[model samples]
Target: MDLDVFVTAHRAEWDRLEQLLGRGRRLTGAEADELVALYQRASTHLSLIQSSTPDAVLTGRLTQLVARARATVTGTRRAGWRDAARFFTSAFPAAVYLSRRWWIPTAVLSTLLGVLIGWWVAMNPEVQASIAAPEELRAMTEPGGGYEAYYSSHPAASFAAQVWTNNAQAAAVCLVAGAFLGLPVLWILFLNMANLGVGLGLMASAGRLDVFLGLILPHGLLELTAVFVAAGTGLRLGWTVIDPGPRTRRAALAEQGRAALGMAVGLAAVLFVSGLIEGFVTPSGLPTWARIAIGVAAEAVFLAYVYVLGGRAARAGEVGDVEAADRTASLPTAA
Candidate 1:
């Protein structure tokens, strides 16, 4: 257990590994084999020192040395388009499908809450009064009112981009905030639904409920579904903090975190589609039923993507995590 003596004995091997890593020249077969042997020995030395008689400076040096050597040995591979294709086709949906239990209920509850709040606001004049003044409500609900005018107020392309950016940011926040036990996610969802309810109430009380549904249903169905998926995945992540099951807390969180990140990306694409519908279809002169039919079709396509491709991937044991080879190698632990 003499640290100085151990360093003296293995210093040559460590130096050799370092030299091999630093060299710009290609290594010969024998030299490459030797580099591998030296890297293994250095790794063993680092483990022993970490476990017993750990020294800060020596440990740090060895840590860096081992990392460089390991990377050199493995060789790095940059991600290509194939990775993107695999991610969309397999990883993204599988992640969503696996987290369905959490988000599906989230969608149901949030919708019911929106409806309840709408009903309350519609039935109770006081609630409507608290939300907005009579003049404001009238301005919002009159024919060619604010609710209908809002969508067409801007150019379609710019408006779609703006909506996409905003929705994507919201979804990202939901996924990232799950680290705080999902409280933020729930609050965000509540706020979103409350706003929807307020609008519903104002329109219904104006006897323009049909007008409101027609406008919202065109894009709201798919748009809100993406938000629900994000929120649900976040809640699932928060629950992972509470119950990591058989896996160590760190491991479970790490796994879920990766999946959540992937979901963030996939959900952005979903939100983009909804944004297009909202920007173009919602404000168009098409009949309400036709616009709603378009929205329903988009929602149905997304759901099918999740259940069909995602379900198949999940059944085949994809958890939406990165490939094993891409994961960081865990250090050796004592039994």
Candidate 2:
């Protein structure tokens, strides 16, 4: 098995493959057929050399050439509507259902924290003073003041767009920061809850707790749920780094990270709905019950989607990651 003789014999085939690949989508029918034939031959040649020889330079060059030829032959696939449909129906929900253990507790604890902090701020004058001057606080919570006006300050469409963008960015941060031991995710949740608490306390202190609930509940229900899902998924991702169980840490993180990203995109859509409710319904002339009812219905629909569709998908072994064919192969590692 003289490597020189093998190289001379296969050089022309390799050169032809390179030429076909470099043509950039203008191949004739005959050329395309030749490209496929060349790719198969190169693959066989690569396998033989890999098994029979140890020439690093030749092997590396052949490997790269084979990969390029293969790509040219198969081409890249563009995502279409079907991919989008599959994501929402299966991947997104499965991720939510799978991370229920993390996000559910996140929702509970964050709500409790906001309620407690709100109560404390309302009951204690010192806390109120620390948050803002009395006049400033009054200006914010007073009827026809900052709190109510904030929603209508901008046009409904603009407000909804702003809210969607902001919430999506926050969700992206949670998903990205999950790898940092989830500390940033927790911090983001805390900051959000703390702000909620302050708003609640200000409203309660001004004897406008009912108004606050009326305005917030309609959108907050679904809005906060999406945030909790993001945070919870992020925390779960971080924990994977700490305890990957039966899988290696890298594998676990990779899997959860992909799932977390899917959740981010899904949650963006959820937040968009919530944003619309906040922008239009909350500030509308509709009765309080009607507004809150709209919010509740949306939240209910989302929950059912997660529980029914997501549950079924997860049970069927969907983990919200990319399709198996798209995943990269990992090297064998000890468990």
Identify the leading candidate in terms of TM-score: 1
Each prediction's whole-model lDDT (CA): 0.91, 0.89
1-335 per-residue lDDT for model 1 (tens digits): 99999999988888888888899999999999998888778878887786577899998998898888777888878889999999999999999999999999999999999999999999999998987888988889999889988999999999999999999999999999998999999999999999999999889989999999999998999999999999999999999999887765666798999999999999999999999999999999999999999999999999999999999999999999998766544444433
Give the count of colliding residue pairs in each prediction: 0, 0
**Stretches of candidate 2 exceeding 4 Å from the true structure:** 1-75, 331-335
Candidate 1 residue pairs that clash: none
Assess the local accuracy of residue 217 in candidate 1 as a C-alpha lDDT between 0 and 100. Answer: 98
Model 2 reaches what TM-score against the true structure?
0.80
